[model samples]
Target chain A: MAIRYPNGKKYTPPNSEVKKRSIKDYSYSNRGKTLEDEIDEANDFYLQRQIAVIHKKPVPIQIVKVEYPSRSAAVIREAYFRTPSTTDYNGIYEGYHIDFDAKETESKTSFPLKNVHPHQVEHMTVVAKQRGICFLLIRFSSMERYFVVPLEMLQNAWTRMLTGGRKSISLVEFEEQAIEVKPTYSPRIDYLQAVRKMLP
Target chain B: MAIRYPNGKKYTPPNSEVKKRSIKDYSYSNRGKTLEDEIDEANDFYLQRQIAVIHKKPVPIQIVKVEYPSRSAAVIREAYFRTPSTTDYNGIYEGYHIDFDAKETESKTSFPLKNVHPHQVEHMTVVAKQRGICFLLIRFSSMERYFVVPLEMLQNAWTRMLTGGRKSISLVEFEEQAIEVKPTYSPRIDYLQAVRKMLP
Candidate 1:
């Protein structure tokens, strides 16, 4: 049995150790899907049941050249990825405009601030000012746990990094400020429940 | 002098006659900008002023091949456009969810229903069901007129078309049911003014 801390979070190995475990561990199974996939599945579940209208925004690409083999078919010959200007997922839920991004980190102890872009922070700030529900759905992959952290907490973390404070949010801080979203089989990630709890 | 109809609208020339006027009029002027550009600039104006947070969702692209020459660079080699599953724009305005698509038509008499995609109508229906303020920003290019038509109006038109009715919304119908958005020097679309008027 693995040793656990007083709070019952199992000890996570170092980055090098975790990386080594994947050596010859290329399991091409559904279990290997990324955090993005899980959230997408959850969003799909929400959409089908009419629980919410949230959707992941499509990936933006800048096209430079196109080839028209026929009048009906045009293919992109050259293009580049455009950095998204806003959060990945946004839509209305019970008349509330909800906006958020999903982030995953292998580190169990802290979530790095570098995962979020400055412009995204600015967008979320404006959304929060509009009184819309804005936040980050962060997944601690190593611990197999998720948390719905509010935008205010993220803004504070951003300020801390700029003012030469901690560059990341410690697990203890998250446990204090965030609402844990337990993963389930059907919804995969029942984040809306946490959102409901967050609502006044 | 232009002939005015009963509603004070100037008589529009036939398409052939109107298209003939531009035989040598290849003007590379700001006036030649598309409705998409106008809406984008208007969105920028709104964003800079912190009015309402709305944005155009980017064109979705499907990637087939990419070349990463370096750790920091990725060039897309092959890609194809994917039909968007929702409207072109959506965001929050004064704590209300706003969703819409922009369409421009050369015809001055009617806005063709063929301009709207079936999936887009379905998506907007879901958004409206969720209590989002959804509509279409339609521009009659030749007349330099724009109208903000409610989704319900579009839905009714769609139903009528399917039930052996007109395949388009006549200009008279638009004038009666839709709000005409005056194009201005600043905020070229001034759509939110129309949206504000729309709010109860």
Candidate 2:
């Protein structure tokens, strides 16, 4: 299967079957399912068993222009992101409040710091202060690896940013602290299992 | 002060002193804001004070076509509501999860039953079973009155449908059970005050 970016450029998934599969073979050839689609599928699976209740928060958009062509339909002609939102997903899991962001990086060596928005990091920090489970699902597309990095590691990365360090998180550092998640068809990416393992 | 809907439709506020006052009127004016604008303002107000953190869930839309003008922007050309969504707003307040739907009815005598969808009612029933606070914010636009009617009342109304009852909720019943919310500028709907009153 061919991988394509929004730019219409054809790309190759890391550890493709055409090449020798690595220990971190987590890339998907499916073209129809987006990152959000996979996450929602996983959420539905969790909900069915009464395991967790989670949802992706809507992107807050300010509709500048709307065309009501008819009485029943209102079409937004122009809109903009209203504010820097809190995170991608949040809800209750096993009697604990869970908050997280899902991010994809094509870098093979490290995930760029620029991928982590300042406002989102601040929001995750607040979630941590409230004792909520906060983390990020980091997808290394080039390495075909996925890691669940806790909010503490993210905060530490942010602190390093203030000191003018490298603009990316090295894969070596990630392997030491981040928990790896194996992908499956039903739940898509069962990162929660990694989360469960991390939990005391 | 002038009263208006978010889309700039003019109206007289419930108790407006000015014949054409903008800021002089109480809250619930749309002279300068839109429906989405009011919901955003209300959510921010709730979050700031650690009050009831309510938010409008995203409208479930099935996008059939997208017109990508640039790499950073994509315009949805065709979309439709996928399924009947549960409610407009939901969040946590003080320890209880609060869920509700807001609707405006122009009929002074009765609110049309057509406005409430079967799926939303079903979602509310599930929420109720989970011990969540579920209700509806019914606004009699012409009468300038708003009420928070519990799901139980709505379920009773649903049952009455089979017996061939009126297809609308009478104003008398709303006046008896629905808590009237005097809108404010900052918090807009100010539904939490009503929530506090509802709790035992």
Best by lDDT: 1
| Candidate number with greatest TM-score | 1
The deviation in Å at residue B135 for candidate 2 is: 3.0
Candidate 2, B101-161: lDDT as tens digits: 8777768798887878887897677666556677888766544566778888888887787
True contacts kept of each: 0.83, 0.04
Q: Pairs clashing in candidate 1?
A: none
Residue B113, candidate 1: alpha-carbon lDDT: 94
Chain B TM-scores, listed for every candidate in order, come to: 0.84, 0.77
> Model 2: which docking level applies?
incorrect
- lDDT by residue for model 1 (B1-200), tens: 23422221234455443444564443322255667778888889888888888998877777777777777657777777777898989988888899999887889899999989999999988888888999999988877789999988999999999999999999999999999998767876789988886764
Clashes of 2: 4
**TM match of model 1 to true structure:** 0.85
Task: Report how far off residue A105 is in candidate 1 (Å).
Answer: 0.3
